[model samples]
Target: MVNATQVSFFTLSAYFDTGVFKYLYFIIIVSLYIVIICANLLLIVVICMNRSLHEPMYLFLVSLFVNELYGSTGLFPFLLVQILSDIHTVSAPFCFLQIYCVFAYAAIQFHNLSILSYDRYLAICYPLQYNTRMTSNKVSVLIALIWLFPFLAIAVLISLSVPLQLCGNIINTIYCDNYSIVKLACSDTRVNNIYGLIYTCLIVFGPLSLILYTYMKILKVCFSGSKQTRQKAVRTCTPHLASLINFSFGCLFQILQSRFDMSSVPMMLRNILSLYFLTCQPIFNPLMYGLQMSKIRSLCKSIIFGKTLTDA
Candidate 1:
């Protein structure tokens, strides 16, 4: 009979273990994280200060920014420290925390994007009813649900993970992930895997389907109007569409990666791609949605130059 010790030890050698590339990757990722933080922070400030942006749409945007900020901070800072340090080992408790944080953020992001889609759906489909349906009270409730629902799910999952025994110390990817962490467990992980897959499908695919359906209905509504109205509607939806596409693809890829076995894939290649997806979205989100918007651009410019003008 084979005991736990009889099981083969899985060694996770560092990919991009070289000094130059490691530092380069560190600097670039850190720089991107800083930009994401600043951009999102500025967006919240501008939205709050400018009464013009006090609508439900901008309120949702601000909530998304805040969520992204917390999400990126949870993973990137620890990864940055690891990249710089000689020691790369993460303890069990810390590892669990990492998994909890990643899942919590991912769930919140999915739910928030879904709410945004529903917002668009109402605005386009119901038109006259949007203002009444998406009131401040309703929006506040939705936002609260987006944050709270994920926490409950994560708490249950982490509790399940607590009893599992870990055999290894090294996590192959830059940051701790559910799959990688489960692979360390001494017991059978089939239950965890099954639950994870089910959760991923519901959290990722379910929202993705809703977004697609909402957009399709929105398009139908847009095209029913005059050519100019159709054009304007498309223009308005373009930025959200870009973000939806990026987010959907990123999330789907992550879910696929999590569900399938990745032993055949080169660890370095996996690390690089994972880092790209994880960091790039937060950086790109603000650029695509907030910075590119005419109102946000004007607000940023005004804030920067207004003080100087006043002083002079």
Candidate 2:
């Protein structure tokens, strides 16, 4: 039987031997990172600088952008470095930190979407109470809890990972995922897997179900109103609904694949889907809001021209 020490050593050795393909993958990933950073930064700037965008919905959007920025930053740079360099190794402490950040950001994202859905639900179903219930203080507290709760969960998960002895050399995916890393262990992973599944279901599916149910109710409320009110409600909820759907779907595929064994899928196919999920959301978000919401498009254009005029 492969012992813990052997597993760790073997995994490290195999990781270092990945050749030219790693560098090529790194370049592609870096390009995607640049796009995600620039797009999200622009979105944040537009929301902040435009007085018109200083409303509840846009405020929630800014929060989403912030979450995505941290999420991508936490996961991508480390993967890029590993791909580009011969040093495909991470210390146990750093590994834990990485896992913590990745999972924390993911949880924050899940909660953010759920919050946004609830926000829309109130806006559509109880317009008069929306402002009072979703007061600035309330929103702030919710956002804080969303970020903080995830870190606590991650701490517990990391503790579970510490006792296991890892003895593998190959990471099947591009990055150091929790399951992928845990699989390297010589210890029985049944408990870890079970706990991981529970965590994922709570973090991913729980929020997702809430979002879906809230939106369904919101839609019913919309239809119950007059044509004008219905149209207005639909307009308000559409962007959020689209974004929520995209985020949930992307996360579902990413998380499920990350948790389960991926031995059956070809490496190339796995890499492609991984890249799609990782790169697509950040890029897709701004475009979706920009094209679908006229106010955002106007703000973006105004900012571009205003910058040009200032520079000239």
| Best-fitting candidate, scored by TM-score | 1
lDDT of 1 by residue, 1-312 (tens): 223333333333454466778788788878988898998898888888888888887888888889888888888888788777765766656767877888888888888888888887887778789899999899999999889988887887777666666776565666667676576788787778787777767777777788888888888887787787676566557777777677667766665666687778877666666665567777777787765578777777777677421211
Task: Go through the candidates in order and give the clash count of each.
Answer: 0, 5
Scored by Cα lDDT, where does model 2 land?
0.74
**In model 1, what are the clashing residue pairs, if there are any?**
none
**Candidate 1 wrong stretches, greater than 4 Å:** 1-16, 261-267, 307-312
TM-scores for all predictions = 0.87, 0.85
> What lDDT does model 1 reach?
0.75
- For candidate 2, which ten residues in a row score worst on lDDT? 7-16
For model 2, what is the alpha-carbon lDDT of residue 23?
70
